[model samples]
Target chain A: MTVGNTTTQRSADATATGAAVEIDQVAVRFRTKKKDVTALRDVSVRIEPGEFVAIVGASGCGKSTLLKLVSGLLRPSSGQVRLHGEDVRGPRRDIGYVFQRAALLDWRTARRNILLQAEMRGMPRAQARQRVDELIAMTGLTGFEDAYPNELSGGMQQRVALCRALLHRPPVLLMDEPFGALDALTREQMNVELRRIWRETGTTVLLVTHSIAEAVYLANRVIVMTPRPGTVAEVIDVDLPVERDYGQTMSAPEFARATGRIRDLLGATTTAE
Target chain B: MAAQSTIEQPERTAPAGATASATRRPGGAGAGLLRFARNTWRPAAVLAAILVVWWLVTAADLVKPYLVPSPGTTLDVVLAQPGYFAHHTWITTYETVLGFAIAIVVGVLSAVVMVYSPTVEKSLYPLLLFAQVIPKIAIAPLFIVWLGFGLSPKVVVAVLMAFFPIVISTVTGMKSIDPEMLQLSATMGAGPAQTFRKIRFPAALPHLFAGLKVAATMAVTGAVVGEFVGANEGLGYVILQANGNLDTPTLFAGLIIMSLLGVLLFVVVELLEYLVLPWQASRRTDATTTTL
Candidate 1:
């Protein structure tokens, strides 16, 4: 199965520029007793240095699978996944991931949770402490640094997750619906906070989400996907002004147009399949 | 749209007022402490009342002294022959403590190994199950026979009794991590060792402690059982001696002392839990308030 040429070329370009992540015609399939389920069909994507890109799709569209490919958590059945021009055979240290759930260690305080990443990365304790302080401040979790995951609100816990993810300053951040578990209000607030944090840190981010509005609000470009055995259906550029305020920018005509195009693509894909 | 507007408007207004109030009460220290006390006092009161009832029931002669000796008589026996019980009590305490330490070390190590290797888990887990199913008392005499009636047998019994719970709890705790957490750690370029130490171990601690608490109590019982089977010293041995002489009051005293020792050990474990996991307490508070 020849994966798309565009994805391969993009990956080649990414390799040249030392792009954070490059997925070149990557295909992933799972074998069960009864059947082989192809999760991604020659899907290819490239994330540039310091770009915020969102992958949006319906359920079973292999959005998470795409993320796993990029994170090197899963190998492509055929084709290549590259990071900094090197084929990513396993998890790369230069990428940070956040999940749908906060997934903080219950026994650890927020500060400890953030430090855990540093400890694993073998970052010196003294350096970790300074970084942790900066992260706590950036996340607006100064007072709750010593609070446990169970003690914080869903939004707060996610903030801790973000801090932990960013602690090591990995060049690429892979977020799989990191705010999906929060309530609508909390999710919106998290989106704003996330955008602000991303701008300040200047880390390239690949966010997977089901919400079109969210994809539009946070990403420079939104890659829409089809149903199971997923392939990229469309890649829409978001032309809205950067440095957004949630209240002022969310209602802009450009924002609505981008969301509309994504929604239309999703609707078409769902009906076609 | 109206609902969204209403929600947004309240949130904006509320944050300003809330921040002002929060700053004014910086850290919420006094109020937080008061709430903490308020929540804890009820449980404390109930426990005190239970103790009082036991005292009153024993004093009222509601049951025969042989069956349920008066608290006063039990106390007198304890005070009168402090040395008599103290020496034996120390023996049991030593055995219990030693066995418990061995169990913790072995349990944690085995759990870590099991998590890392499926082969080890497959082979050793069945053996653990087999060991746990056997009645500890039934093996106490065998331990005495094998170890030759010294402190070794008692300690062996205690270790055997305490080991299973810690292993099971630790294993369960280690395996119970959320997939997302692992993914997050992996994406952050953390290696296997880093993932486990930072994520799995800390996440599993509460469960591990739960098992440890149960094992602590079991360790004491194992020591006592060991003394009962064959031992020159310990509260259990004293009970056997008092039984032979028909000194019901003294036997009751020994039982009371044993109970006290168990309670004290359990309290020490609880204290350690609190010290190790201070964040848990605040989390519990947050849960209560949010639910309300």
Candidate 2:
């Protein structure tokens, strides 16, 4: 992935290829009419290339804010968020964001929404069309490509959203509680699909979710965050093997242990706050 | 998502109120027709009863024939001078259409400007509301003063009347977009123009069409009001001359023709909405069913 802004040199260990994110003492403040609210404070983390990282936190823990900072959607009030080796100044084409809701354009058909990436980039029509067909197939949305968003079920709509995010093949993917809206069974199934896709594409992913099970099931490392003026409370590494299946992962002892540890950390943070 | 039941889902129900008989499962074409007639007959019966009461009133001379012409006499007048009514209808139709077209362009452009800039919205929104409060009928004569007694004055009045609703609805539609949708677009590297073209505009279309339907009927009234003040042609002029001469049948004929013009325009707008926003039309649920 090509980095931006040459003024700051790359860190010695950061690579020239593969998407890498470095959050250096990042902070975000909202200046409201009544007072200044610190959304995030001195939050620092690094995501290596192709690593699947999940952040688990309560509502006001600034998990979504961190994702925004990484995607260059929000500027850090202090320090910097770097993609690859360069600082992120604004939105770039190399990052993909999947919102909590499917958020598909209701007017556009499923295929057209996926091709929105190409439309935004001014990519060649023929190439975009070919890519759209492949993504529809990849996301198991073959027959439903022409369907409007309202015609699809909630889970199907989220699948369409996933296809749209992955259409441009961005080096880094950021997801904010993507499966949180689905029912339990569908959410588990989608978790399986997401893991399979991540394994296949080897794209670096940073997912923020409120579900502890989801964070442990999907990521190599789960970042537990504290609430209000949010900062990282603990980073728990998942010792489970990379080749995880929904059924097997849930039953595994290591999975239980990792989730239990993160849960305890979260419980303690909320009480202390 | 796992497929549920999968019995083809009954061909997806038509938009709400479009198919009251659509719920009935019919064994044959005859049954389908009977069901359709059953759903439609109530309204038809009410209309027939009203007509009967009117005829009885006329026969008993409850009201003067000149003041309130019998429905039959109005029909006869309409049949007698079809060409004259048609000429005036065409003129009124042109003015309404032209004014509506101009309103759509100017209103939507203004809405876009206001949506994109906070300063413009703050300054212009109250003024738009102010313009909406002043009755368009009151200003119809002023348009004639500036543009003279021609098609321009009538068209101007129609535009002034139709413009506010379109702008209000368009602005509402643009702002109603989910914040997540905007954030997703930003992450996709979409510039302002691209976001508006592909996302905001298309999403706003259903609301825009809703406003257009209201504006379409308003346009006809606006044109007629302008004609009421000063015009040599149009159904409004026909009505005014007939009223002066106490030609009640001709006046009633003019009123019918003018209203028919408005209804036709409204239907045309609805058809356009269906074509452009099939997704929205198809997704509508029955209003009663949607109550919490």
Candidate 3:
């Protein structure tokens, strides 16, 4: 990926491409009219290029808040967030965000909705159209491009949302519980599809989800988190084979051990909190 | 509208009311026509039943003829004075249409401003509520006194009556957009103006059309009410003149024509909505027929 904003002096990392995302001692505190709430504290992660990282936590663990920090949608109370060695001062056009809800514009057809990113960024029309077609084929949304959001099933709607997010070919993709609303079966299918898509695109991904199975199934490493002043409790690495088949990956002992470790860590964190 | 705003779901923005009240797509040309027929049969049957009841009440002399004219007598009176009735109908129609047009422009503009600025909304919303509660008919004569017996007074009344629903619905639509969408827009580097144009305005349309349908009927009520206060012409004037003459048939005819005007305007607005918002779920229909 051609990193924009070349002005930021490149960080020294000879073995790998400089970190795609760097969160340095991050913290977020929401001050409402009443009490003050520390949503996250001392949270830091350095994500390398093309890495898939999942953050699994309880609802109040501020995992979604972490994703927002990376996307420049939320500013940390103290520490810094950087993308491609440049500080994230505002919403970065170089990143993509997928919300828990599909959030598709109902007035636009699926193709047009995907093309919304292009419209906002003022990308060249022909280039954008070709990219849209490629994404449609990639996402298996080929036959449903002209369909409206309400006509599509929930899974299909989220697929359309995924297509929209990937249209610009952002170097880093941030997903905040994207499949949280889908049924178990569809969620499984989407997880398989997402893994394949990530493999094909090689985009760095930061996914925040509440589903433990989903977290272990899709990420290189899962960051288990604790609530009540949200903090990272543990990071469990999955050592399954690269070509992870859905059934095979689930049956792998490494998957079992990693998932078990995560569950125990979460159980301890809940009581400790 | 306030109560509905608290219960805001994406579904809340769906064009709501009548099967005809609104929502999604249906199939091809022939099928759409067929669906239209199927939908209208119930309302047609209701109209037929009402006509039958009216005839029964008149023929049985349940009330004095001067008080409640026979449906036949009312129809005859209309048929008798095609020119006179048509002239009055045209005047009222023009007034209602003009008022509705002005209300839509003003209401939408104000709604945009109010949605963008909390200060404007804060200052104006209570005044809007107070104006609505005061009753247009009560102050309609004041419009006549200020604006005179010309069409402007009646048009002004129609505008006043139709304005609130449009403003309320537009505001709701503007606010109903998912916060995630705005975040998405920001990520794409869309400025505030582009966001409003490409997102907020289009999002507001379905609700705006709903408000338009409501306002369409209200505008007619307003015009007639304004005419009631002071006018030398229009259907409201015709009704008053017929009542004084004790010509119950003429009075009944005027009432029928007046309501027809309202329904006609409503249907026009509905048809416009259907054309403009084919994307709305209310209008969606799948193709069940065999296609080549």
TM-score of chain B of 3: 0.85
Taking the candidates in order, what DockQ does each have? 0.34, 0.30, 0.36
A137 Cα displacement, candidate 3 (Å):
1.4
Q: Which has the greatest lDDT? A: 3
Q: Pick out the ten consecutive residues of candidate 2 chain B with the lowest summed lDDT.
A: B13-22
Q: Please tell me which predicted candidate would have the highest DockQ against the true structure.
A: 3
lDDT score of residue A261 within candidate 1: 93
Worst 10 residues of 3 chain A by lDDT: A1-10
Residue B162 of model 1 has an lDDT of 90
TM-score of chain B of each: 0.82, 0.82, 0.85
| Model 1 ranges with Cα > 4 A deviation | A1-19, A124-137, A243-248, B1-68, B285-292
Per-residue lDDT over A104-194 for candidate 2, one digit per residue giving the tens place of the 0 to 100 score = 9987777888888888888899999998887766666655666667667777788788888888888899999998888877787778878
**Candidate 3, DockQ score (0 to 1):** 0.36
List the candidates ranked by lDDT, beginning with the highest. Answer: 3, 2, 1
Query: In candidate 3, how many Å is residue B288 off?
Result: 17
Computed on alpha carbons, the lDDT of every model, listed in order, comes to: 0.80, 0.81, 0.84
Query: Order of candidates by DockQ, top first?
Result: 3, 1, 2
Point out the worst 10-residue segment of candidate 3 chain B by lDDT: B1-10
lDDT of 2 by residue, B1-292 (tens): 1222322233231111112222322122243334434545787798799879988898889999998899899999989988988899999999999999999999999999999999999999999899989988888888889989899999998998899989999999999998888888888778888899888998889889989999999999989999999999998899999999999999988997888799789878876665566556555532324573
As a whole number from 0 to 100, the lDDT of residue A219 in candidate 3 is 90
Cα lDDT over the full model 1: 0.80
